[model samples]
Target chain A: MKFDDKIPIYYQIKNYIYRQIIVGELAPGDKLPAVRQLAVNLTVNVNTVQRALGELISEKIIEPQRGKGNFVTEDQGTIEKLKKLLITQQLQELYENLHQLNVTDTEIVSYLQDYIAKRKQVQ
Target chain B: MTNTIEIKNLNYRKNYRSILEDVNLTIESGKTVGLLGENGAGKTTLMRLIAGVAKGASGKITVANQDGVPEKKSVISFSEQLNGFSSNMRIDKIIRFYEDVYPDFSTKKYNEMAGFLQIDEGLRLSALSRGMKEKLVIGLTLSRDTKVYLLDEPFGGIDSMTRKKIIQSIIKWKSDDAVILVSDHYVSEIASILDEVVIIKDRTIYTQKSAEEIRSKYAEGIEQYYESIYEGNDIDD
Candidate 1:
């Protein structure tokens, strides 16, 4: 995957995996690829991949099976929480950007609603 | 034992001219480090010192915990070794030569890399293009089961496709816990794969920073940060 050079690579790696999970590309309880395989696939350092997986393991989003490999957490609640967290982070960025443009919070909401309506009409 | 490279108080002078002075750097296992510097910034000289090919530097250089030149040379694979081979020799013959000289050279790994790199072992070194030669050099370097790998500008003068292939081969073949130090003047080509970057300037190590730290702290790409270092100093001192 192409990466933005301005962001920490491990952070981008974590987000890539999170995106796969949120999109159901990786189902709960599904085994993740071996760390070396992931590193090769991403064209990143194996240590960087390990760092990203380490954070995921700590967050309980992934479970480590001794001598086997890593797997996505089976808890549907945890997956849901992860999805909500991603959405909130993205919305926060959008909100802050609009605020910088001198748009009030109420106007930001209205503008987002209008934008969605226009997009739906085009679809 | 962990594979590591440690250099202390290293200095190199030739014919009363100092090439490098007080160079100190330590690289732990499992890192893919980028050695960044302008041409003649002592990047190649430093790698030569680490690989034990160049002598007369009054400092301690150790690789895989061994300080002796022969011991250090045994565990390190330097790309410059290919220069010693005859251009009339076929690719397969060179591989055999490597096997005979370096007990650590693995024919099996060489074959795998050869196939992955699409190198024709039957072709003489003179028949290969620049990109092909580089691919062969990289294949030969990585085919060794060594603790440290020093790649000096493997991507220089190569096309983008060849560059991408080399990058892929590096990622695919790098053994865990074995450090690879790749030196290149251009940063963006190999930035993503690097764990840390060591910038050499003015005959010494200017700075060494983790790649992620540069990204997160400076909010800039490795190439940008490297370029910023020489912004106003375009004229040589």
Candidate 2:
């Protein structure tokens, strides 16, 4: 769990948990580790972990059950939305970077197609 | 009482030489703060003052709402307290001494930390290497259930693996309501674990900012920011 010092740690922590959920490593309805456990595992401050979990709870990606700890949201629709949001965010970054390089909209689409074709053939 | 530390217009001098000047800082409970500065930048002096070990300061120092030195000493666990122990003393003897001297010292916590740190209580202090001695110091300091913990360069001269392990242990053993102030000149190793960073420069607190805020605002790591501040100044060392 090496972190990028240039980014907010809480934001990175959120992404880490989101990745686990998206990859099904944290299955639907699975209980998340306690805040202190996450802090120790990540070598981060407990308050930062708490802030990340608080945001997740507010976003409905995690549901806090009384006395049982936090669990991954059981709603499949919410998970799907989360996956879409992550893809959109990544694609936005790529698009913006290409735009800065003077890449046209049509050329960006062709470049993506070519990239995917090359990646698939390599796979 | 709230588990907070407050310093008002603090000043310390030794032999007509000023170590710290007009230092004022407040640390709230539930934070892991990094007290960062270069060597001889008064980082250790500041910690000693907060621990009530250093005297002759024209200022008010309060820990957990108590302004008296004895009260402050009781609530603070300082890493350098091991200096008073003889090197021939066994680790178990030191533990017993702590348990007898400090009512807040916990053998259960010490045992857990020692087992995790791979410390053999049967070994004498003189036999331990530098890294091993540092581990013992950290384990001993954190074994006390106190309001404030002052760890001065707990990672100095240790291997990265051992430093990482100690960081994990600190995170694991930290109580939610107690504040831990860790001082280090090197920032990268402990940057992620710090809630906020307080930098000492020119004999006073140069700046104190949230670690996340520094990352977000400067778009740089704490080490980089700290270096940038000293870029133009003629650093003595």
Candidate 3:
């Protein structure tokens, strides 16, 4: 779990799991690590893990079966929806920053292409 | 294996002077336990004994064991009362040292904690303030993912802001099956968080019970409970 000093830890965990789902690393219907297991593995408090999981459940990214465990929801559309939600937030911030810098859409797209190329190479 | 801690007939003697007398106690796992005592009440010694740091202590300390014996490094994370880091070591270096020693140490967790704590990655430990250094030590210790955590006077010398951060870290570090033993004199700050309270007097475990149980049994909060015990009043009153 990569935590941000500026952001709440639960939000970070929620975003992390969402990213995993978007990247196809955590597939639909795959069960996540148990709350206790995740807490032990991440060294975060179990309550934090529970909070993260609960948020995911509410977001429809994961579903919990009573007495069983939480599983990734089978709906890819929901995943896409979450991804769009996060992207909108990022875009809003980017728009503000670019506007302050007086960067045009063309220049931003060119810069983004270069960034995407570099990221792909690293991956 | 249920999470439980039990000590029986524990005794420690140095120079024919009893450091800890026969003491028996049991603390169930998955709860926050506060060990309250004034200075020289053997809180550190008892924690050390539970952590297996002392070799000459005579007794059985059991954690989740039917036989009532703590397995080696099995049931404890004893943070020393004194700061134990090398003065010359870098902060990250000490973290790596603990990473190698404790099987459960997580680099990812350390990185995450570092970010949350907003600690400078490149600074040497000696460069940090006393409060920041304590936070760093606590972050490292709490990142061990251990079953039993023993923190000795973690709130000492730190400001209220740092203390709140430390407490939040503890809340995050605790698991459902873990037992956290925090030793401190600031009973008020910790009393709210503790599930159980243990008071040490004359080097022996004088009293132990859940916070609610203690309150119900004695009609007083943890502070008054300690006062009564120290004043030689019956705990059941």
lDDT of 3 by residue, B1-237 (tens): 364788889999878889999999888778778999988888888888787777587888776564323454744666772267767678777877877777887787777777777777578877888788778767777777777888988888888778767776776556668889999977766664577788898788877776655654555667777777788877443
What lDDT score goes with residue B233 in model 1? 33
TM-score of 1: 0.95
Which candidate comes out best when scored by TM-score? 2
Candidate 3: true contacts recovered, fraction: 0.02
Per-model TM-score of chain A alone? 0.97, 0.95, 0.82
Tens digits of per-residue lDDT for model 1, B1-237: 354988999999999999999999989898899999999999999999999899999988989999998888889999999999888999889988999999999999989988988998899999999999999999999999999999999999999889888998998899988899999998898998999999999899988889999898888899998898766433122
**In what order do the candidates fall by TM-score, top score first?**
2, 1, 3
- Tens-place lDDT per residue, model 2, B1-237, is 354989899999999999999998988898899999889999999999899888899989889999988988998999999999998999989999999999999999999999999988899999998889999999999999998999999999999989998999999998998899999989999999999999999999988889999888878788888887767542222
Write down the DockQ of candidate 2: 0.89
User: Which sections of candidate 2 miss by over 4 Å?
Assistant: B1-3, B232-237
Clashing pairs in 1: none
Candidate 3's residue-wise lDDT over A1-123, tens digit each?
A: 333322444556788888888888999999998886675455445655777899889878999999889999999789889889889999999988997899898999998899999999999
Leading candidate by DockQ: 2
Model 1 / residue B138 / CA error / Å: 1.0
> Per-residue error at B179 for model 3, in Å?
0.7
After TM-score superposition, the amount by which residue B144's alpha carbon in candidate 2 deviates from its true location, in angstroms, is 0.7
Candidate lDDT scores, in order, read 0.92, 0.92, 0.76
Task: Please give, as one word, the docking class of candidate 1.
Answer: medium
Q: What is the lDDT of residue A60 in candidate 1?
A: 97
